[model samples]
Structure formats: structure tokens, C-alpha cells
Target: MSAFPIDYAAVFQALPGGVLLLTPQLVIADANEALLWRAGRERHELIGRPLFDVFPDNPDDPDASGMRNLRASLERVVATGVRDSMALQRYDVEAPGRPGTFEERYWSPVNTPVLDADGRVRLIVHRVEEVTEIVRAGAGDHPVDRVRMEAELYTRAQDLQEVNERLRLAQVREREVVLALQEAMLPAPVPVGHHRAAVRYRPAVGALNVCGDWYDLADLPGDRMAVAVGDVVGHGLAAACVMGQLRSALSAAARVADGPARALEVLGIYARSVDGAESTTAVQAVIDWSTHTLSYSSAGHPPPALLHPDGTVELLDGATDPPLGARPEHVDRPEAQVAFADDAVLVLYTDGLIERRLEDIDVGLARLAEALTRHRGADAETLADALLADLLPPGGATDDAALVIIRL
Candidate 1:
């Protein structure tokens, strides 16, 4: 009785609950240090192991059935020395590479009847408590059920990235108002004089940000010269104000026409007298250049590809017209006449170069005539950037596109 100054390991390490001793053949003689640090193991891995081989119960995980109903209520108080109680439960412990952490348990059991002085019963006295902080304080009243599912997935990804950044800033302000209304509708790029020199342009991927396709090179007053490409129906700012009224009534009907099918019949009676709030669809051509002939027309669009000088390739597809505000019963065809001999190459485009709709427009027109006959040895801005990298098949084009190239 001289060593009975008992501090029994500070009363079983200040028993908040979770003490053990299950011997009567269930092994695990003693454990405390908070059940050996919640079984992450220590007291020599909890003395002789057993208690169902160190708390094994997860049989198909019903959250390990509250430690398997507290080992069936401590086997009914070790078969009779009776004393039991249980309450706090809830456990979802899955700690293997973490990520799931839930716990709350409260248990009880006590039984005693061992004595070599002439009595026998052995051991049992297990208790545990770790109410996982009262189930995480009742999960703070379910914070609006988890903030209404993270505010509807952050408001549908912040409204689809704000409508794709407002359609890429309205296609960069409609290509800066289609280059300030195509520089107030054709003012200079010279050649309205230099006999036999014309240029029409609208390549830079147009109002997809190139501004509604456009181009013209005139030298009218002497041995005429006129070339064109146009498209204006839908796309920002009413297609840049109907592409400056069909490029200023096509430079005032190619300076009072005499070719390109009477300057597209004077721009189709100037597009059936506009005012349906602007609309367009054009393609004109005229190059006499001292009898090196070539006249054209096509009030609807997309059919102009001629590269001769021995690499033979011509396509000004037969008759087509029905685009400008589409009515007044339109019709202005025939523009495939060619005699552009010496090193010729004329290509006008505006259905974004041989339209692309996943093959078959005759296979995107035989893949734009085999990529303009395999870049016919480039150089016209590398054959218009290798025919837009061989008709965009590597991610480019959800819709809008444009291009135009001509070299003679």
C-alpha cells in the first residue's frame, strides 16, 4: 500500500473516453493514449492487437456500422456481468489517401469477475467517445444546403465567359467599322490609272474580323480594268452598313461601265434600289488589258478560281444570282469567260474561300481544287496563306471566314 499514490496515468490519460481492455479471449489487453492515437497505432501497436484485429468492421461500408454496433454492445456486457450504454453515433471514416473525414462515436461497456483467489471472469471495459465535434457543429445548419450547390455552378460558368467576351468585342468593333467604311468606300490603293492593274481585297478573315469582304482595282478611262468581291448580309453593324453600299455602288458602277457584264448590270439596278435597309451579294470582273480578255458576273457569290498559264484551273461556276435583299426577281449570271493567257492567275473568293462544312460541297470543291493546285508554288502572300492552311481542318471556323486573291 506504499505505492498506492495512484495517478493511474493521470486517470487513464484524462479519460474523455476511449479506454480499453478486452481480454476474455478478444485479446487487446490495454490501450489508452486515446486508443493509441485513434489506431493510427503506437502503444506497441496497441499491445497484442485482436479487438477484431484492431477495429475491423467495414464490411461493405455502412460506415463500418458504428464499430459494428459497438462489438454487439460489448458482447452483451461480456455475457452477463452486465453494464452497458450507447448513444452518439455516425462515422464515415475512410482514411486511405485521405479525402473523406467523418466521425462521431460514443460507446460503453464494463464487466468484471476475475480472481485467481477462487473466482474467474477476466476482462472487458471499453468506452469511446469522439463525437467528431458534435458532427461538425451540425454542419453549421447546412449553410443554405451548401450555398445552393455553389451558386448554380458559379452561375453557369459566369454566363459562358460573358458570352465569349461579348463575341470577342463584337468582332473588334466590326473590324473597326469595316475599316472606317472601307476608307469611306474606296479612296485609294491606286490603279484607276496605271493601264491594266487592279486589286480588290477583303482578306484578313473578314468580319469574323475582316469586315464584310471587299476589293476593287480600277483603270477604267483607258483599256478598262475592274475586279471585285463582295459579301454583306449578316454580321455586326448590319454587315458594316451593307459593306459601304456595295463598295460605293461598286465605284459608281465601275465608273460608268462598259464591261464585267455591263458592270453587273449597273450593280443590278444598284441592288434593286436598296432601302430595304442595306443588303448585298456581289462578284464582278473585267480585264481587257489590251485584248488579254476576261469578263464576269455573279450577283450571288463564291465561284471564282482561275489559275492558268499551263497549270490549268478555271471555275467561275455557271449563272447564279439571288442574294442582295433577295427579291425584285433578281438574275445576273455568266462570268466564266476567260482568255487570260500569259502567266494568268485570277482567284476571287468570299464564301470564306470554298466554304467548309465538314466535306462534300463536292468535297469542299475537291478541297479547294487540291489546295489551289498545291499552292502552285506559292507567293501571293504564300498563295493566300496556303489557301487558309488547306481549308481549315485544324480547328478554325465555327462559322465566319473570308479571303480573296488575284495575280495576273
Candidate 2:
């Protein structure tokens, strides 16, 4: 056999993988240019340095499990001795200004003999393949797979954003529509030169945008002021249309309403032909403010609650009948009342104002009264807001609410 001499450095440099040969005491015995470049260190700084101290064994990456993980990987490699692939296994290598970035590196003790012409393991060879990109789903060219996956992800994100934008736009439009219709139903607060007043209406949680909740205020001749609130039975465009008709008819009825009962009879008869049970309930009052008396009527409506100056409240119960939509014969006329106080508050509202499935109507009414009691110090607007907050049940409501607070 012919004897052969070799150049160890040239041989190692010729290899493709990043290679590092470490001495027993942890000094970098030798390292290929590829290893030095990947480690981002100069050749002069590479050798004569401890593996942990020189390489930095990236311990900052939690997935790499830190230094404990780095040491564990070394332990397995030393125990096994045989080189193994790290395609599945993960570890970390130090990076400048970073604790450690993850990577997959293989370790194998070099087969070169320590004793001359004798077979003995002397140096440990570390082969590192940066598997960070692979673990992060950025590894390998994977042209067809990666390109298609990236395109799909981008498309999905765009679609979700577009859908969310559309949803937001639709909500805004819905609110605008509700506000518009509500405005149309209410008469500009007719400034009763001699009377001070306030009105408020709020929609329920599940109530469709713009349903039939309505209110009206008018200064009729004969020193009488007519006020009314009613709910139609439906929602959306149809409900709005019918509500407009009801509001017109109610306003006209107030002209000759005389008393709460007669005007309601006019309404009941009109309702039978227009929208019997299909319509909703309401309470109307014609106030002869000068006399300090109110002529009010109820049609399947909760009675009006009176809040006194002393913070006490009372409800007016009088001739009442089923909602107009039920049947012409089932309707009742309005009632005249002299029971109202000289310096008191009167509140009228739709069913949505105090109706909740979580509590009975009486409880809701009691809550309303309690709310009124708490608002003794509040002006009309503040009192109205407090009433809404207090009367609205836990969770939410499913209908529209309207309120008119009149202080006499």
C-alpha cells in the first residue's frame, strides 16, 4: 500500500455542511468557513473558545428551551456518538444581540484517530443545518406548496377584512334609518309658551331598526295640548309606513278628541279598518294645563304614572280596552281625570319601556317608579336618562321604547 498525506483544513473546507471541530476542553479546534459565516463570527474569534461561550448556544428561544435544552442536546449527541439527523429535533444557536435563535444541528465525534496509526476517537465534529426557517414554515424552496399556501392565506385575510367592513357599513346605515323615521314621527317639541316639557324614546336591544314606536305633541285650540305615544306591530319599511298613517290620524283625532275616551273610539274604529290587532297599544292625553286636569285614554296600554313633587308616584287606572287591532267592539274610549297633581310629573311610555321577560310587568313598573324617585333632583332630560338606565332590565329588551315626561 502507498502512503498518503492529506491537508486536513482543505479537506474540511471542501465539505458542504457547516462543520465545527471542538477540542476536548471545549476550545474550537477548527471550523469551516461556512460555520464561521453562519455563526456570524470572525475566524480569529472562532478558535480557542468554549463551545457554550463561543457559540452562544442560543438559549433565548423558548422553543429551544434555553441553555438547559442546549446542554441536553449535547448530552444526547455525546451519548450516542453516532451522527444523527436533526430534521425533527430542535435546538438553538446564539446570534448577535439576540439570546439565541432556534436551529437543528447534528453532532458526531470525528472518526480520526488520536494515537498515531491507532483507531481512537479524538475530536468531536458538529454539523449544523439552520432549521429555523423549516420550523417556522419558511424552510425549503417548496415552490408549488409554499406559493399556493401563501396565496390562500392572503386571500382569506382580505376576504375577512372586506366582510367586516361591509358589516360595519350596514350597521351605520341601519342606525341612520331608525333615527330618520323616529324623527319623522315626533312633532317638533311644540313650545307651549306657558308649559315646559321634555320627551325621550329609546329602542330595545332586539328591536329592528325603526319600528312603530311613535310620539306626538300638538297645541290644540281651547287651551288644550294633545300628546300621544303608540307602537305599531311591525318593523322596517312597512312598520314605518303604517306608523306615519297612525300618527296623522292621531293628530287629527286630537282636534275633536274632547276626552281621552272619544278620541280612542275614533282611533279604534280607524284601527279596525286599517290595522286591527295587527296594530299595537297606546295611551293619549289631552291636557287642559290651565285647569291642571288631563283627559287620557288607554288601549291595551299600561296606565300613565304620575311623579309628584314630593318624589312619590301614582298610576291612573281608568276605562281601558284591548288594543285597537283586536276588534272594533273591543276598543274603549278615553277617560277624563281630575286626579293629577298641581306640581307633579307625568310619564307615558310604550310596552318596550318597561317590559322584560326576566321580570314581570309589575316589577318593571316598580323599577320605573323607583327610577323616578331617584331622579327628584334631575331635570327632564337627566331624569329621562336615569329612568331608562334603571327601568331597562338586565340583559336587554326586544322592542322599542318611548317616553314623555310632563311636569305640571
Question: Best-fitting candidate, measured by TM-score?
Answer: 2
TM-score of 2: 0.56
Q: Candidate 2 lDDT, tens digit per residue, 174-236?
A: 667866876876777556656756787766543234567888777778667878888888766
> Candidate 2 local accuracy as lDDT?
0.65
Error of 1 at 180 (Å): 22
Distance from true position, residue 243, model 1, in Å?
A: 1.9
Clashes of each: 10, 9
Predicted candidate 1 versus true structure: per-residue lDDT over 1-408, tens digit per residue: 656688877887677656787776667888787766664556775578787655555455553455555565566445433455554444344443343433333222333323221112357767666655554555456878545643443354345445645855776676777667666665454545544333334334323534456666666765666778777665555565766776778767777866665676667677666653245677788767688877787777767778876565778766556555555654544555667875577777676555553444666667777777777766566777777777754433433445555566
Query: TM-score for all predictions?
Result: 0.28, 0.56
Error of 1 at 32 (Å): 42
RMSD of each: 27.2, 24.6
